[model samples]
Target: MKKTLFFASLMMAAQLNFAQEWKPVGSHILTPWGEKVTAQKPHPEYPRPQLVRTNNWQNLNGLWKYAITPVNTKEIPQQWDGSILVPYAIESALSGVGKEVGKDKALWYTNTVTLDKSVNKNNVLLHFGAVDWQCDVYVNNQLVGRHEGGFDPFTMDVTSYLKKGAKQEIALRVWDPTDDGPQPRGKQVNRPNGIWYTPVTGIWQTVWLESVPKTYIVKTKQTPKLDEGVLAFQATVAGSQAGDEIKVRALNGTQVIKEQVGQPNADFELSVPNLEAWSPSNPKLYDLEIQLLRKGKVIDQARSYFAMRKISMEKDENGIQRMLLNNKFTFQYGPLDQGWWPDGLHTAPTDEALKFDVIKTKEMGFNMIRKHIKVEPARWYRYCDSIGMLVWQDMPSGDLGGNHWDMQPGKISGGNRDKARSQESEGYYRKEWKTIMDVLHNYPSIVIWVPFNEAWGQFKTKEITEWTMANDPSRLVNSASGGNFMETGHILDIHNYPDAAMPDPKIFGANQVLALGEFGGLGLPIDGHSWQQKDNWGYQSFKNKTELLERYKQLIRDLTRLIPMGLSAAVYTQTTDVEVETNGLMTYDRKVVKMPEAELNTAHQALYQAPTK
Candidate 1:
């Protein structure tokens, strides 16, 4: 007892030391939530919302020992420079080590965790929400797993590496090439300027651990079949025997509506009576309880939820394609949301901070958001789902300096030629995109998938578009938003600056949904909230808030007129200012709202109520 007490005291003293040493390292503007961050527990919430095991998991998101080493140095370091806040990039202010780790250096993180061996049933799984570029994970100095791709979550089983003790050591070595490599890094550059922003390195999302039974449910796909009034449910079990079964129960606020049992690794169709279709107005969600059973005895279980929603396309009376939600035409209008923070960079400061943007978007009376070349954390999409906000998810653009971005009204000659990416580059793109889709397949808020944006790294456009459609036929695929105008996919999207416009209805409106993928970049940079004091810019700079509001209202009026002329959707320039680009409804720090949300909401009602052909 005395020895354990002494060890506990030592640990407490060490934690206090770390708390005193850790501080946000930059002078850049910070959001209200960023200011509240501490080294004790940063983003301590459960990382995986989709697959919830309740208190059976642990968040590994506090300060950890970090070191910057030369790229050629493969051995683990004997000495560490200082501490870094886990799940934040080294370049970010919240990491407390605001130093850039470019292509020439590797970022190393190491930490110790205490595992309750008695409670951890059969297997221990180490999970990373995301790690930028490439990473190699070690468990007690043993190479447990290696993963690439900066956006997708990867898991490794670290049970075998455990000695017969509660304390386990974890280490990770990460290397991100940023722009030097052909990976799908979006808007990240070593020398950030204009539209591009700071380069993010190493871990930028939640890292955690989950303990589960020997036979556990890895992931489940819950697709809402609205037409048939059924939910197509499938579970992927990790370890299973022939008799192992999965019992699924659909609940409505603790009341079980329906239940079904099926063999592990098989599909189960559950009848949903009186379906309340999820939409921008009424986002109804149903709870789920899945249990893994063997010989009619429950061993493991998880809780999750899903919404019944459908997205499709149909031609109107004038033979113009129109996007339909739940078999009804709903004009979608929203901002181009680039999920970036001045403090955390790619990661949000807290879960509440992450949900704030989505909540604000819905409050502004926008039905949809074009996630501009950036994928947010899963919690961001969950907030969108619950708050009745539609999302158009874009694949992060990379492999630049080799593509044409022609967007002439009548002619798209320059964009016809695609970038010739090398074999490795093409392979990386394919693998990462598939992984991202697989990870985010269960979210209902995502109505559209944008494979490429503005001809950036666009290669084999038709092939890629067809594969995307075939992979998930549940959602519409925008081939390339404002990129090469290919006769592919379901939408023909274009971009116009500071004005609301759509594709020529007489030309491309017959077979495709006419959409203004980007427009209305009216900029008004507030004095203190601006990323940089001078040289801030937008497509059309405004002097004051009143002027900006007037111009934005005019753009909405123009966009309303296009709705009747076969215009299906329109995405404004952006949701918040990013770096030197001062074209956002809100400032980069999220401190000030350029226009009143009530007024913007009232003005946007006209576009949704506009008559369609």
Candidate 2:
């Protein structure tokens, strides 16, 4: 009887252990970092790199109990299904809960944190790196606030939500209609096939808590004027008195460059002497220290960095319009980077994984990346700025109903046949586009703003393009990337699939630069790395790596031929395979290298050589 009882105990213990072990739930392709994920710590890095605060902050990105219920339900669930990974979208494999939450269903998350009394004495601020669609945040069951938008970051002051103890309970309720709603969701839908992908609901980025002084510098905007050798900046203050002043300091690796005094919420310029211009080949960044002062005493301080660079257009010796970086013509060649991960979707699994694509693109001899129809986390752009990779940012497309298109080089008309949009839709586009631009404007890598892509939600072509150009005059504007021919923007762009092509200079030679926005989607699907086994496809499919490489090399050779014809820049089809689209330079899982990097780099090098005068 005793032996029997002991065996029963062992069996019970084993069962509980098995139940608690964390494992990814989906069978889709997974990245290397995804394979190594656990419930302990995920993406444990400072989420905001540009605004660095090293002390009095905590990471809340481990496992959290989650539930999916009908959207009509409001009460918190008495019991959770299981632990889902925080910061990974619920539909993602890395979330450990590959469950779909539809438009009729609402997703929920709950976690607990132990507040440090030493730090909690200061004002506590709750930060959600990003949440999909719409969400309501609660601390200790009290409603703190609400937010809308799937891409940008939002924060709330939750100090009042704290109780007398060290522990505090936080909850999140999220609902995302995905493609069902007319929002800025990029290629995500209820049905997953072709270019559209699985819906991402709930928290998809780092969630954390920080303590700050009552009077803190909430945000800082920096614009560098290299020609004038000065950095113009402005700071937004949260809680401040009338006489509060601001102190700014610039440093180049411990050597002080400049220091100045300015008032909060006032425009000020700091002289940067002996400044080195930032470019693709030579990226230099200067560290910045900003402090908020009250009566000559420091109240709040933050750290940041900046780069001195300029983007413009110039007429070359051949009397052709050319895109110039720092007053020099450097042909921008890169991939149409659709920022997606097999494991995390919009959010990358790790910081290192996030930077991997940019590093590989640079290695493959690409100077620029057209961030396609989607916005990435701020860190992605920061990495590009640090590594000196140029960026052309595209506003994510929505309500995309318009005429079909063909790459008509040198077309005189912008084909101004834009989509007829309702007033609500037009206002939504304008507001969101402006907000996105304001958020990402500080990054020096983004040289161009692509307002529309392939006529997707292309409306008010002249007005939108002109507004974009006027608002950010520092960078050249590609108003429509491979869309309806527009006469308003700086570049005349076109898209052609699976082959090298370019806009003709014959028609618009004097006014606009000619560019091939997209081309060369050479696809090779390895058996184990694909999202789906049987139905995967690319714009142009190849049987093996050898054939893919040869075809890719030939395309590169053909692209070089267009340079003398006033082709200013070009973008390849994509950086990596996402879901059913198997036309990536790298595999979805990122394990297989379809083409030899050295050979591809060699081919890409010839495109950037000096074109004949």
Candidate 3:
């Protein structure tokens, strides 16, 4: 009876602790597109859309055990500090463990999970959406793998370490040197003040597991050509035997476009008769089904989709470079999406929150968004494709070798050209940059590849531009935007402050496309919607929506004159207000829209229509 009573007491305590875990916040805010993000089912869709798998897959999201420890420690602490929501950064309030982890310390995460019998029969791959800096993974007390790099996804095959039908312990150890080390830590500082806000540590992305056969498909490539009316399909296999046949299928809605048999690693072109081209308007995607077959029997299968579209830069009327979508010039204008949320740092609080940003940006009548310095979940890009928005993906900036103040556009101590040559730094940057590009190269909405932004760790600009051209001849390369315009690439970009400024098309030669890479940081601080209380700032401060709207309109009106002079694209400061940075169309909480929707929509529509001849 004493033992039974002790067990009952322990169960009561467990239930009490479960009740106090991190609960969803900000469920009441109606998104900019009138869609409400509620607590019941926030971000319910599959996070990774690029790679689809269907076998022993389980989402290890919801809640996890977490602790903070010294960098030198290798053992788990006796007690967890508390529960935190996975996929959200530690510095975020929604993560429950709102704390800072410096270079001197490490964050540890532990979780116990029971593996399905099916996963043990084959290979089990453990995947992380992203981790801040460095992470070591262990399954069932055995170290499986380790990964470095915060923003990219990494996986480890954990088949050998599993004990079927028994609970397994998975542990992760992470260390991030935000601004303290020479890594690609973008806009993260130990003491986040001004533009640099909050340092993320540990796993700030979804953790999950999937089961695959002995010989399975690893990666698939989809390249669409609208003019040819064909989609090129290629599959990279892991352990395929000789005489293996792979079947590829393309479906539009419920109708099948084409299906054919092909060998692994070989490109197979599938034709679509009545293909509807993908664009900012009428973005249509055809569903793709892939299967691996042995002796005419299907062994494994996966699903993916692709859109038929092509992006290029060509000389338009009067010999000025313009972005050509489907062989025609379409001016791309949208906000500089920083991809930050009030509750979640790297990960959006909910899938609806992720979709809302794209939807709202579209409602503002913008055709494109320059995703600045951060790669988001694949679903974010999928939503952009669905809702008809173009994307210019920027690799997250890091290794600036100094503080945020040191990396500003016009603040270089010397104009000495020799200082730009850093062979060691350049090598490391190229390695990481290639990894980032290879990972996100499949997404269709991503048009422009920006190698460097404002000369942050920018060395050998001309060579890097040449390499980017050789690597990806399909897309346009903006070697460096805003600062240190080398006048080498297809686009001549400039970044201005509160006021919009356009680069001289004549100075860069008549062939270069003039673009305003960044502008319009109009700040309006809501009473409670702020990361900090004092010293909050923006490019241009305003007390009310009325003043903010008037100034924003006038700025766009000034930009209209530059369009005739060869301005083809313009990206505003940001989509949402980040911590301590109040220059956003919406407040940090995403509860308020700072500008009148109609007025901003009218200004953005000017870009969509061709400039007056």
Candidate 4:
């Protein structure tokens, strides 16, 4: 009877925790998913989908103590503000503290974790999926480490700071200057206007802790060589001994497909008997298992996955440059996805919410998406790879003040002005861009590396483009999109508002793939679903849903015509309405899908059926 009463008490406590709600603190608007959010369990999914471990991890995404303090404050504040929902930026409404931490103030967060035997015995790793600008992390009042990037995940080995059978305290201090600082912030400004949106501050992604063995496989770099029918694997081991061997196995569900064993931190290859290339038509992925063994005993293991895909450029039957998937001519078309939620700024409200956007794009008969000047969590790309959606990722632009915005670069345009950034700012840009590439290099969906957009913070064009191409020769490089037209990249992209238009084939067709990087921003603002109370904008505005659907279909028809004109791909304005921009197929709140899915899908199918010009 005592044991039964104890179990009942525990159940009651769990129910109470689950019932703790967190209402959005903003007046702008709220998404459907926002209402479902709770302070006790926010973004409970495993943060990293690409690199997965079955167990020995804990989610630390519950309510956290947050305080906005002076920028130069070194010590922890004596007073603490109310609880804030983590994984949501402090500036975001979903954070439960819709407070701004400007250049002069730093956002502080503190939390405690009750360590069990499992976490205390093994080497502990604390991971922050992403934190804006700069941050200093502390464990038990000792400075653990510091990170500078806003979009890349950072991990710190906290095994040394662990106290067995005791509560481990974690604290973070974050500072972001927004547009005032020369970082790749991607349309984030203190003031919200036509193009720029609200700023994101502090932690905007998942925070978790994992326990690993003393000697474990830290990372594995997988490169599927489609032409050779072999998968290249490079493993990096931490705390590896002299006799440790790394075992890599590619599995088809439960069946072992291929296996290879090599020394720790070495390279090896596994050949597939019958290679199935990954494409939009058939998205085949092989499950990967990596194990670290010492003295022929399994000491560490990690689960991962990969796809056999090849992306390149080739000339079609008409001698026109085309973007090829698996060495075949397949036109890529999708939206210029900004990846913003009404509740969470840089972060998605939930894992389901993140996957919903990609699923909708695919269901709408799109094969690709141009991820606009913002980076998403790794799981977003994993969904694209799983569901067969191509990605053109843009490097977030910074230092926009010094550059000139060239609306259009006509044929034969050569020399153009470049942004003159400080040496410190330029170094930061190079470091962060390389880091972003390193973190997202494994995903198969990413086909193109776009270094600049609309000439924003464009500097040393030829040099940067060449470097980007050389760094990853496997993927194509789009140096600039709709900016100072340079004759250096694989794809020459142009942005034409409201209608579909490609780069002039006579000049760029011979060398680069002609693509309409952005167009067809047909907008319709639903009366109650709009972000703004009065002012809202789109490239082309409409009154009713019927009118919006008609204009969108017309734009699709115009896009089909461009396919025969050597146009490789086209990106519509957006996936959802963001801030005051009502140009999306869905509204800002994700409550209303502007056009019917079937109608949009039917119109989009015509473009894919067209022959290459």
Candidate 5:
């Protein structure tokens, strides 16, 4: 009887272990980091680095129950379908439920948040890094909040909804229309082909819970003035009384450089005696600490950082406008980064994987990256700030139906330039663009803001450009990247394929900075590293690695000649091959790097020389 009971116990243990195991659902290629992910914990780092509270927080990024119901369903379903990963989208292989949730269907998720007395504080904030399209969140079957953007983070105060028990349930219903709606979804489409890729639904980023005091700092904006040698700091305090105070300190390592005390929601400037300008060669950053006090007693505190750098434009000896960093002319050159992963469609599998691309870009000797049509997580920008890589941020393009593109210089006309969008579409664009700018304002790496790309969803050119300028007078605005050059913004940009070219110095170089937005799409697809076995594509395809390398070298040589003709900056085709687009320096899965980094670094050093008359 004892032997039989022991064998039964072993069998029960084995069954439970098998049930708990998790694996990726699809057969698509995955990055090395994706293979390391487990169901126990996915993104185990702090979600918000800018406003960090180290001790009292929980990372809720494991598995959760998911269901796909019709859009007409009003209430949360009683039974869920199966278990899916919390951060990965339903259409991705990492989610363990690789299925499409279209316009007619709504994706739902349910999870429980346990209230541990040691971790739960006076106030609880539920935060989401991002949710695709539209999402409505509920806590304990009560609606908490609804958010409607694919790229911006949102938070909700769920402290009031806690019950007497130790567990609280969370339900999320997400709806994404992809190309059918007039939202700002960059390159997602229902029928992905060519340049377009797969549709992402539901959560695609980290979700966590944060604990704070009754009166805490909601947000803070720290802007550095390089010319005046001062740092401007402002805090948005929540639940503040008349006598509340905000104390800020700027530190170099453990030593305090400057300290100041001010009222909440008011700006304060602190002076730095010896300020070092942040550049690619020396990316120096100063640590920061902010505390909230009531009558000289500390209530809350958080940690942050900032850098001292500046971006401006000035004319050279030849009367051509040149891009300037810290009042010095420096040539900016890099690839168009798409920010996609084969395993995790919209999100990187790990934080290390996200930083790997930027590290590789720095190793390859590029000094800038034009983040094309997609906004990455906050950590990505932090990596660039510390590693000294300049970023050109692009607003995701949508409502792409009413475009009349004119790419040439002299052929641009007022009639076909800006598309007239509907009132609904226009409202969505304005709100989301402003929110994106507000969220990314503190990062020092972002140097330029791009509004439109090649007339895709371009509308009200002069009005939008003026608004963007007035909103943030600190950085330069590209207005429109490649086409519909209304000559309103600071840059005159153009796109050329397979060859190097620039805007005419005689026509617009005196008034605006000339930039080659895109060029050099040299392609060579590896056999085992491609998305598909056949039908791979690029702007210019090659036979092998040797031919591709020679072609790339010739293209770089051609690009170097144009620098003397007032080309201030240039962007290559891409950083990595996304989907069927094979014109990338690296493979889709990030496994194979076709070109040698040392040779590329050596070749790129020629483009930075001072232009000769």
Candidate 6:
């Protein structure tokens, strides 16, 4: 009887373990990370690292019952199709319900969260790390707020809808048109192929709750001036009184450099002695502590950091333009870094996974990476700063009209005559461009601002470059990369594939730094780890890792020659394979590193020591 009972118990345990492993019911699937996600403790870390608070807060990740509702539906569906892990996209394998909602429907998410007893005081603020397109939030059936921007974070005050000691139901409705609209959707498309991939909709970021006083700090901006050895700050507050005091402290290791007391919403400068400038070779960061005090009591405090560095353009020995880092020419060679994951789409599965790419890039000996058409989490940039990696930030393109022929590499034959954008579109583009600059202007590692890529929705090249320069004179601007070069801006950027070349920087005579904005897409697909078994392609296809490594080595060898020929920077096609594009150094699942680390690292280090003109 004991033996028979033990056998039955063993069978039950095995069944339970199998149930824990989520399975796919259709063609859609979950990411590898998705399968590992658990609702017991989901994305429990503080969402906003920039601005932090010690008030009542709760993470709303975990499992959320979800359904696909009609775009115009006003009532909640009585039946939920299945459960999805919060923060992961619906198309990801982790979401549990791998399905495509497309552009025609609104994806709805509903979850009930109990308010902690301590959070009953004051106003409760709900925050979202990001949402794809348009999203509306409702708490306990009360409409709370809505946001439009897809990439930027947004928040709403949900104090009025809270019931003390009771469970509050939170509902989110999202609508994303992706390529169907002119919004800055990046490289997302309905029918993804080649460069574009599947669309990310609904909540693709962290969702959490925070309790704050009626008045709080909304945001803060810190800018460093290396020449003057000063760091300038501007603080924005929601409920700041005219005479509110803000205490700022700058620390290096355990030593305090400077401290100052200032008024809210006013410019304050703190001086430092013997400042160490930040660069790709030496990224020096000073820690910051900010406190909001009322009547000599600390109401709120947050920690931040900044780097003191400068990026400028200067004439080289050959009278050609070159990019200067701290008054010295530094050749930047790195990957294009599309910032996509086959399983998570825009979101990476883990913080370590995100840092892995930057760490690997640095290990491979490249000092810079062009963040192509995607804005990574702030942590990614922080890692870059800690590891000393330069970043070229691209303002993701939007309104790229469908016409596959236009995107083809050699479809245009010789370069077609550069054309200008319509005045109306140009006006809207400028407005959005300014917003993007203002949002990302504080990062010191971002040395270059790429306004347009291959002329997609590109117009008024000269004017746009001028505007970027005037708005942020601290950084260099690349007018248009690879397409419709107007001989404007501080960088004469080009795009080459599997081959590296440069235009005559002398003929332009603008003293613009030369860079290859895009190149080197060598694809090799691993059978077990691909988005699809067939139809996978890259700029150049290879059959084996040995052959791919050889081709890569040849490309780097050729690029080294271009460094002395006025090449200041080069961005390799990508870091990982996405969907049907199998040209990444790492596989889509991130489980495999295709090439030997030693070989890739050795090849990458050649860029730093390569002789310059």
Best by TM-score: 1
TM-scores of the candidates are 0.98, 0.94, 0.91, 0.96, 0.96, 0.90
Candidate 6 lDDT, 238-336, residue by residue in tens: 788766889989899878899998888889998877789988678898888888888778877777788888787787777877788887888888888
TM-score-superior candidate, 3 or 4? 4
Of 5 and 6, the candidate ahead on TM-score is 5
TM-score pick, better of 1 and 5 = 1
The residue ranges of model 6 lying beyond 4 angstroms of the native Cα positions read 1-35, 117-120, 402-435
Who is ahead in lDDT, 1 or 3?
Answer: 1
lDDT tens per residue, model 4, 325-378: 888888899899999988898888888899999999888888899999999988
Candidate 5, run of 10 with poorest lDDT: 408-417
Write model 3 residue lDDT over 381-490, tens digit each, in one string.
Answer: 88987889989888777767432222233222234231253565565567767777777777788888887787676666678777887777667887677756665677
Ten residues in sequence with the least summed lDDT for candidate 2? 406-415
Candidates, ranked, TM-score: 1, 5, 4, 2, 3, 6
Clashes of each: 0, 2, 1, 0, 0, 4
Per-residue CA lDDT of model 1 for 18-83, tens digit only, reads 788999997888989999999877888877778898767888888889999999877777789899
Clash pairs, candidate 6, are 29-93, 30-93, 31-93, 34-94
Off by over 4 Å in 2: 1-21, 402-407, 412-416
